[model samples]
Target chain A: MTTWDGAAAAERVAIISDQDVVRVRQLVRTLAVAVKLSLVDQTKIVTAASELARNTLVYGGGGNAEVSRVDNGRKPGIRIVFADEGPGIPDLDLALTDGYTTGGGMGLGLSGARRLVDEFEIDTEVGKGTTISVTKWCR
Target chain B: MERVPVLKIGDILLVSIQIDMEDQVALQLQEDLADKIVVTGCHGVIIDISALDIVDSFVGRTLATIASVSKVLDADTVVVGMRPAVAITLVELGLSLPGIRTALNVELGMKLLAQEREQYELDLEDEDEEPAVSTR
Candidate 1:
């Protein structure tokens, strides 16, 4: 439904709804400066962002994308979490592998996101929902 | 907290898009980019799609359009981070773009920008020098 910076933190952005992929990317564009993400990295993040948003819209029926800054004392990074309450991926392992998509895309949404970021994680329950987290560090 | 949140940097001016070597969206992106460059004066543009699982004719045409438009706008363009499988698919499909600048990764695309900028500056200097020489 909307994309806004965190309620309490300026660095965080919460995107709600199936149509918020563009909004999430817009948020990323705004934060690119502080994050120092390269032009290519930005595209990678946006592409994955768009894919995830679409997945929620098409498959999950709706969901939210949450983004925030991450710090581990040494490096600063961007963290994005996508949550959807759809049917969930039936095969987690096959779904993560490239060239194995049931959807119309290149089947690289999850894999591509993994490749683009420094860290990637996914959790799903067949009947419950799915949550994916990805992070890219800024040096 | 009532703090006004403003985008700190300049509209995140630079963005490189990597589309499947053959996607119709790529062409639309070209038109979209042309308009942005005309209005915003952005510097970075990278289009890398190494994980493209498919490449069709429409996608091919779109890629060509994006390359051509970006060049006309004097924007730096780089086709980087292409997946080998995708590349093979494109080649097998015989899809090719005439003038899209290409590199292996986003890093290479950034390097290309440096070179392109230097060339642009030198061309401007040449134009400036020519006017002075003609006066004498």
Candidate 2:
């Protein structure tokens, strides 16, 4: 099991509007670069954050994203958690399936975000909300 | 709402996306491009995305929509200057950006647009020369 050390840096950005999504992307990119991730990895994580952030805003009806720089015993990584108090995902499997979307999107947000990050976790309830945590470690 | 500017050079409309655009902004740019295509009577549209660090699904879809919209307006659209890293990430994200033509840089994209225009003119001339020749 991988255990993360305390975050060296952290920030939260609201995902309530379209511009907030862009801000989330910028925040993730800054943290990814600070973590010393490769260019491709940085791009991947930032893109994933953009997708998830949009999901928070569009489908979740509004949310927040927390970006953090963390370290395991040997390597540094960036982790982002997106949380929203909107309609929870009814079907986790279907939500993770590519081309499956309830929000009129391309259905690539969840699945594509999973492919981009090294670690992914989701917590949700039917009436409560959804929180997705994704991490990309330096290699 | 910040707007992406569209500049006209010769018969082509050039759009260099310099901002980290919001979703609404992306859609707005698509509408603006469609209008510009008709107003300028351009034959081609070149969208330069070199400044963009990442092209997520929304932006990718927007670009494809812009390409298809331009096609309906009788203009070819070429997306140019995608960074190597962005390309790798976009492919991994399962977005191949279908229906949108791409080039390495603006210069090459311009060349492609010119070639496409020349080919179109040639095809038109061929049709005019032999009206009975089957277009199939």
Candidate 3:
């Protein structure tokens, strides 16, 4: 279910387990390279995608990641959205804290991923799981 | 279980993470490394991660655990050949990898490990030859 139109080159993959995290990183890297993002930006975006994919697996159970190359006005960028249908975050503020984790993680995925990207947004419900979207623009 | 082969170079054990690291593969590497360290009695371990483009939190934790375990077995560990981009990403990921030694390339890493082993030998010799004497 994408409303991205034809302008954006997009792909989706399941984030079900640890192997899926590797796949998500590869997909994000492919899109970032295709858009000619600098090596630093590519690494940042790929790492961010990895953290989110793991979160979708470990925290949110199983989910999927949507990666797209987009144009934000004249600037070209890559956007990744991760969606999960498992138990949702109970408190957004606490989850975004730098050293808070519920599942034995280093507790840096949310805040660290946010720092790596140009934009970040998250939506969650008590019982409806979560959606976290991030974008990294070429610099 | 997916196993990562550990190559023996003199007294140094070298493991290059060249493939996509599945969680099982990482665990296997840890188990195999413990056994190899005991059997080979290698004094140093060098992990080459240059081929790995990204190291997430879990992988980072695994590497740290490997280093710690090797340390307990009297083997020093050095991680070498991290890409510049991966370094930056690691910083952003907030994993400092404290107490883990890292070098730029395999050659440099080998040199560092040699120096470390030399120092360890010197320390042992001093322990055997010299006794702590209290001078009142």
Model 1 fnat value: 0.00
Task: Please state the error at residue B64 of candidate 1 in Å.
Answer: 9.9
Residues A28-115, model 1: lDDT tens digits? 5555445666655555555555556556655676787777766666766677788888899999999878656676655555665566
Over the stretch B5-71, how does candidate 3's per-residue lDDT look in tens digits?
A: 8999999999999987877788889888988999999989999999998887778888898999999
Report, for every candidate in turn, its global Cα lDDT versus the true structure.
Answer: 0.59, 0.91, 0.88
What's the number of clashes in each of the models?
A: 10, 0, 0
lDDT of 2 at A6: 60
- Across B35-109, the per-residue lDDT of candidate 1 in tens digits comes to 776777765466655555333333445566666776677666667776665555344333454577778876777
Q: Which has the better TM-score: candidate 1, or candidate 2?
A: 2
Off by over 4 Å in 1: A1-19, B1-136
lDDT of 2 by residue, A1-139 (tens): 1222366668888888887988888888877777789999999999999999988888888999999888898999999999999989889998999999887888999999999999999998878889999999999
In CAPRI terms, where does candidate 1 land? incorrect
Whose DockQ is greatest here?
A: 2
Best by TM-score: 2
DockQ of all models, two decimals each:
0.04, 0.85, 0.65
Alpha carbon lDDT at B96, candidate 2? 91
What 10-residue stretch in candidate 2 chain B is worst by lDDT? B127-136
